[model samples]
Target: MLAAGRGYMEERETGKQEAVASVREIFGLSGPLYLTAVDWENSHHRRSVAASLVQGVYILERDRQQKRQGHQSHASPWWNFFHFQLISPLIDDVDFSIFGAIYEYNSSVFEHNAPKYVIAFRGTLNKPDSRLRDLKLDIQAIRSKLHQSSRFQLAMQAVQDLVAVVGTANIWLAGHSLGSAIALLSGKNMTKLNYPIETYLFNPPFFSLPIECISNPKVKHGIRIARSVVKAGIAVAVKGQHHSSQKDDSFFVLSDWVPYLFVNPADHICSEYIGYFEHRKKMKEVGATKIERLATQNSIGNMIFGVCVRDCEPLHLLPSAYLTINMSQTPDFKRAHGIHQWWDPSFDGQSELHLFR
Candidate 1:
């Protein structure tokens, strides 16, 4: 994908240039992809946001810290402090030089191969702990934390920049877990705005995205404007859950991804209720919504989401609503923990995917 050419992106004689081009090429098969990393910008357990211009795809990972877990100076001060950077090894898994360039691989991508000039965007605090992240459903303290969310906003800005830079005619996005949800939001938003940024979402949490916000006609109109080329594009979502998923399946959307992606091994809609239907039912019996909403505006929304957020209105409804999609399931092999990494040696970008939908 990478070649010695002085096109739109500033060309470099070094192999590093080839790598970024390769990433761009792979993701760009769909469009000039941009991946922004963040747990919606809530708390400390955030993974670093690293976006590789892999082929036509822009892979973004977020480095986040654990919620509720207190800190003196910082949680991961000694470490890289970014969950996104920790997954650096994945950079080797893809052929970023596929961007019409003669590509080469090396340590530079592992060390410091990011674009020389990065345009950083600001994060927002939309809601507090409305999206649930735990099984215990213990969000009493979390409610006091999350004040707002800045994940989508920050990602949107980064994506806009990437679009301007590569100016791809197509677009696609893919990610796992929370990253997956973010990708869908960004992709759907861009599409709605008429940006024509097609998307490829892998294992996104249906429970996290704000349906109301995404479906808002205003947001849709915004996306329709930036969209140049027009194709519903491909969509994919991967999912698997444990006993909690009574039906042993997930939901689906018409976007060309897995019908639904599972977050916990237990159930497909774990984040919908407070904790357990019985337990949350009891909480609702009291006054959980009022408390949760109050907490949402308390910690700037960031603090609440970093801890507990499933109690909020739209976030709590994510899993349930997504559970309603018509999905076509694919058989998948169960592997160990690091199986999700991009460079897991045997990681197959095309293989693990279920594109039939």
Candidate 2:
């Protein structure tokens, strides 16, 4: 009986390996693959630019995975496809793994309507080697400690250095999932410093309940009002004590620098953003702007920490964004939250945009 059980377990493991191999081959994981075939020089709009930036991020993932499999140098076709060259890879010192990279467009080949440089960060990978550190950062993000992480600090410094060298007008930032959070935070920090850079965030996590999933509009509205009132109370309580003029100025300045936010309704991790922006519009319509504005800037967690320890802002709160929602149907959560969907030809046309302030 023991011998038979061992044989069955071994067979199952082998089957899983074969299945994984098949999937990888189909997706061209063994080699470089382009997600889109758009003409780079002829087309230079939001969709095209976003595709290039997201692809740069995808290459970062491929580069690291290839290295893990003992490949010394893995040439990425996606970077070449967009006529971009890998400049410097952002490394996580703790794990010595590549979490992000900077790509420079080939100026001689394409000069019109192209970003001079793009810095992209990859999301979490479920692989055995890097999962520990990646998840550690994810947890830190939830606790608002992501800014203090070595990886985020490295990303922020890279952005600052690049901006100093090339100026903020020509640089772009892109990331997916966890990477999106890093890019978003980095962009926010730079914006606060009076250097706003163009940013693309794909499926960035919103560390709140999926209130957007509520089917009834009235119930959802009621819940939002209740939550806002509670947060507003906290904001008022701490208003006189911890609120500083500099902090208010920072938030006001950030309101004018809007980043491009790409989200899918099926992706619960990011879908709350849809409701978040929509709720603000509704608040304006109903004359709750004063309460909403106060609530928007303060959260329970940040208020408590600000009074007790130090001032901290909610990571997910943003003053403005060019919110683009993927309206196309997705098969599952993974597909919905995937970075690949951002570049899909069908998806390019299926997205709807709303400018939120």
Candidate 3:
């Protein structure tokens, strides 16, 4: 198990180093990977729009190809230029895009470390409607074991195949935004399959579902009621499950490998969902359903008093960090949510003071 301090340091370095390589290898994207990761507008609006449209189509086609083949594409999009596969194709008929990056662990050189594998999932690039559809699919899968979508099914196959080939112990899972959620689900599924995995998640959304009602005054009442029900249900469902402790013999034990979660302070996915989940897990152990209810009620009350005052802070005690990505350049709150924001160069590279206990 990785200690909290060491894990945080290792995660930051791994992210910085891998972000450069993963961006270039996974996508045939050029220039800065962070720039393409977000829909940042340049002076030429037409070119940006056209490029985004083209990228959207490209991503969807890749998703389709992986599904049709029942695994990742046989010939990676990088193969013609690079003349090699980053990840080997595992299944003949699985779904979802699961790319493998071959690297040597101990060696600094790409070839020297010989055969270490880092499996990565790409984030969303499609239009909002398509993204939302995928989000719902993932949510349904998580909420119900019987309702496995192509993404869930294929992710399991991919991880299982890789674990068989590489052996389970040292394998790493990485992803951003939507991809982060996929990686998490895949890791959780892998755990149940008796394969422990190390995961690095960037800007993973809380529950990975859109909270449209959170901001809409007309829908606030309904949102609160829905949230209350969800709070109670999660409190009941996840009670007695220790999220950080690895000592459990049960299925949900996170003991096998440490997870490194990176997000901005304002990221709703990490702060809100992660916080809520952590709070509930603690309550479950103590059999404190009343406290859980009070916490949920208090959060709702705070939101009503002044929505902006309610900051969805991530679980400070978890191995989490605030990436100080400058947001002044882009005023859109939506853009601030991207993992790309954390990689910006303007801010000091280090994460804020450790909040985890």
Q: Cα-based RMSD of the predictions, in order?
A: 20.8, 6.4, 13.9
lDDT (10s digit) by residue, model 3, range 1-357: 001111111111254332112231234343123332222233122122222222222333344433434344322332222222343432213333332223213333354212255555545433222345454544453333312456546656777877888786656666555555666667765665677676666655553234432566447434544665665555343443523332442222433434556554345545454444444444555676564543442233223333221122111112223322232454444544554344333433323322322
Compare candidates 1 and 2 on lDDT and give the better one: 2
Q: Which candidate is the best by TM-score?
A: 2
Off by over 4 Å in 3: 1-85, 89-115, 127-147, 192-194, 208-252, 273-330, 347-357
Point out the worst 10-residue segment of candidate 2 by lDDT. Answer: 1-10
Model 1 residue 126 distance off true place after TM-score fit, in angstroms? 22
**Candidate 1 RMSD to the real structure:** 20.8
lDDT of 2: 0.70
Residue 283 CA displacement from its true place in model 3, Å: 9.4
| TM-score-sorted candidate list, best first | 2, 3, 1
- The 0-to-1 C-alpha lDDT of every candidate, in the order given, reads 0.26, 0.70, 0.41
Question: Can you write out model 1's per-residue Cα lDDT over 43-68, one digit (the tens) per residue?
Answer: 11111122222211111211111121
Q: Which ten residues in a row have the lowest lDDT in candidate 1?
A: 228-237
